[model samples]
Target: MNKEGLYRDLSTVKQQIGLAKQFLESLNSVKFDRKNVLSWFKKLCGYLTDIILTILEIRSILENHVLNKKTMLLYLYQINTTLSLYINTFVAECEIGEALNEVRIFTTKKLSSCLDGIEDVLIKGISTYPENVGNFILWMDTALEKMSEIDHLKEKEKCLKAFSDAKILFEEVLSHAMSIAQVSMSEDYKIIRGSSQSVLEGLESLSNEISKENPNSAMVKLFAETCSNKLCALERKVNVAVLKICLSTFAKYTDDLENIHKFCFNTENKSKPRDLDNLVMEFDLHVDRIMQIGLFAISCSTNMATCIKIRSCLASLEALESELVPAFNAVLLDYCKQNCNLASILKNHWLNEAVLLKRLICEIIDPLAFCQIVHEENKYLVHTLSLDVKANKSKIDRSVTEQVIRNSIVLDDFLKLITYEEDNIIHIKENISFLQKIIREVKAASDVFLPQEQPELNFKVYKRCKILLNGIYSLCKNFLVENSENSFSKEESLGNEQPVVTGNGFLDHIINRGKQILQDRSILYRSNKIEAFDLRSTTLSKMNALKEKNKSIPLSKLVHLRKISFVQSPTRNQISCELQITDIVNELRNMSLTFEKC
Candidate 1:
């Protein structure tokens, strides 16, 4: 025999036999010894058969290519490695049902002598181009060296994908289980758990690898795997939780089938099929993966260590699924029994049957009433405070003074309202005093209105005031700040912005014309009396152009033309409010005079 040539030929034969041996071995370990094991084994074998088909196809290509000496050596290596990969791939491919299993049966049987246990399992080979065989081999060697780092990550990817597949299977089992009895369901449940555990262990181990430095993309993959694991687990948990919530919280008793109907029949929305369809599809996928993969194996178990690890994973998954049942069911029941989130329930109700929810209309009405009361009170407070500030100003920019005061008052009020705890009785008081502080500064600012004050109004006062008002309005509209829809604006009506009111003396005119005059004297109003003491002057609404390109920005930032702060003086609102105050004041004065005459 030619020493070198013979050795090479033998090597080729050795490789071919080695690959075939692995598949046969995995086939033998197909759990056929156990009752359900054969089912799993058969499913796995289906994938293996396809894998073998793919291999034979790829192998045929080797005949067509002419190989040089170096190419031949590499090509021979490629053949065996490629074959091994086909087998391993049963657990490797995504979405598709490829990536055959890692057969560790033979290895498992000889765990005592690991080195000699099965060199076949110990070796990992891949087909490479003749030129790149050196590089491929080197890469694999290096990979093995760093295997400890990526091993977890590799396992995780495998595990996650497997779990995903198993989940699909579980759905089928769960459907059948539901139709059957509890004791019967228990056996199938174990199978689902075992499949899921195999998937999770693979993912978790990978996640732990490079979770620290984010090294190589292993961490990202690890994270993705972890998320997938978490998500899949949560998906199962969600179904369990939702069922529990439905039966107990929204429905009836422990033994009552009516409980299920409570969730199905009395839905908030009218479309039962729409809601159920969505839930069913989502849940169906979740469990199907488990059942489908539970009884399937990619290839035979040729490696003892791999088999041991895999079995351990399968056991863990089964344990989690089977053992956690009571707890999960209890959790759902508990959620339904006590922890009813009104918001969540309402949302679900709406989803279940929106039209039906209309029946509960009055339950949402009182909150609206309270909201209206708050809005009216705010309007009275805002106008009053702004007016008082203007009255107090000395010789400042009148417009500046009014605006500054209004803005300050509004901003303060918002800060108070939003931050105010219902338990805390504090708020930016909507009184004259808060406005008064703004009035003084605004008056001073008004004297300087042109370049400085005008800019100030644009930058500081007007802009700020606009924000505060808009914020309050929006908050109130959302029923976050004030309350009911009709409280601020009429619903089903195209609500209009408060119109711009032009002209001066509007304030003083109203005050003086009041039936009950606090004082009939048209006293000096402003510093030089140039500005009138009328509500109309300062209260006029303006249609300032919003200089914004992006309309989505808050209305406060875009529009600041006008405001209706109710910070008016006693005689400021004319026929509206001031007149009423005046009439009362006059009556009081006349009474005092009568006392004097007496």
Candidate 2:
């Protein structure tokens, strides 16, 4: 196109766009008075906008061929893409707004003539109808794709995060709507068709994008079959499946338990439990959907079977059962007693059962306190073995690992609160005696595990685990020091009852000492000798002697003695990571050969 022709074409398109925007603005204000007029006006506006935008893009691409054919083509495509998004957004907002308007008018206008149907009709026409939902998903998926291709990494990241959040929010809205519908207005078959179309369209777009980043198209295809396109329509069935997943397995139960505990205990909001119930339902639905897809895969029968087999390896103990039952029952009964109000009859019994399930969850999770649950649940071990079966099943996603830890710690803290006797006034610290012992054992185990090559987390996780454990210890120690002459007599366990580990001044000493060790400024020498079973209080004679000696020690001496108990009793070698083994050996040799003292 020549310059004169191009100018004429651009001006014509601009005029058409201006007219179209005006018509759209009119539709935005559509009322009963102008609804009929604007309805046809909106259709004309859409047609003219599409034609003009397309023509403008074609002209731009033709004019810029020599210098900017590719660049201009991409730019024009983007412009068209954005205009297309605005059209969809405008239509959706306008339609929904109009439906809302009709519902309000009918309800308040006291129109007793078939008015109840209007509210339901509006819902069906604007939101829950399969066609509307399918259209919404299509528009959202395309807009997200265009947004994903933005040049800036930060912008790309923000868009991806927003897109993910929107997917979650949209899914929630879809599920909630499906849940409330008494009878499906549309056939189950139609709903499935709509949901499947939406899923497949979005899935293909996401899959292609994920494939570009992942570079394992064939593996993705294998998993692709497991992401059923009909999931949104199967909400009820999926939720049941999700509940089963949450309640039926070790990993799933512990994960849910932690989440629920946090929901109950760790919220700044008073409505956290309410939010948690919604989350729990959502999670259960997810579990159901995942199971439905994974368990029913036609070709990958073995993978689902393998997941089940892996789950069966949860360690069962006959003896721990005695101790676990009561603690579990106590928490359960308390929760059940709290939630006795009934919503539905079927749910009343089930909610009561959940009231009782408090015990099973508590018992199953209590072993985590003793560090035995790691060996019990052992998802890592299961994944390692799964490698042989599938030869392709990757380890759990990093997000899963993070969620698990965050949840587990929250539960552990909850248990700690329950176990702590905060109001015993004089003897409120029955548990404080065990804190140092636990810390010592954790430190020793960490050291032993540090040099191991088998588990393959040597880079940092051990240190991280050690830090978390130390934080817990510091927390306990501060509790003791803060309440030295006082008690938890005036306090509740919830609502910021105690300070975090770093809140105490004494732990500052330990942290600074660690930093010094890291910088090789000092070696931690053994401060106490390991006796030959004499000081261990093996016999009545030694016990009597120890009691006699304990009564006379100064307060400073007692604190030093207790702290030294964790300094690796009887080990002669200095404990420091940066200390060279060779240097120590050479020093020993030099000491042996040391001659005439000058």
- Candidate 1 lDDT tens digits, 87-153: 2222222223222122233122222121111222212232211221111111211222222223343
Off by over 4 Å in 2: 32-50, 53-381, 384-598
Give all TM-scores, in the order shown.
0.14, 0.19
Q: Per-model C-alpha lDDT, please?
A: 0.30, 0.31
* Residue 448's lDDT in candidate 1: 51
RMSD of each: 38.1, 35.8
Total residue pair clashes for candidate 1? 94
Write model 2 residue lDDT over 1-598, tens digit each, in one string: 6877755665555455455545444443545333453354346435444533445344443332321222222222222322322233233335444322322221122211112222222222211111111122222232233223222223435535533433443343233223222112223323422343344355446445543543343433333332322232233222222222332232343454345444443335343445655655644433333222222211111122122221111111111112222322223344432121111111222223333333323322222222222222223333443343243322323333343344334334434443332454334243333434443443454354434533443323333434444444334333344434322221111111111122423323323422332222100111113222231122224224434755331121111001121223334222221132223233333322331110
Reference-based TM-score, model 2: 0.19
- Clashes per model (N, Cα, C within 3 A): 94, 3
- Residue 11, model 1: Cα distance from true site in angstroms: 99
- Top model number, TM-score: 2
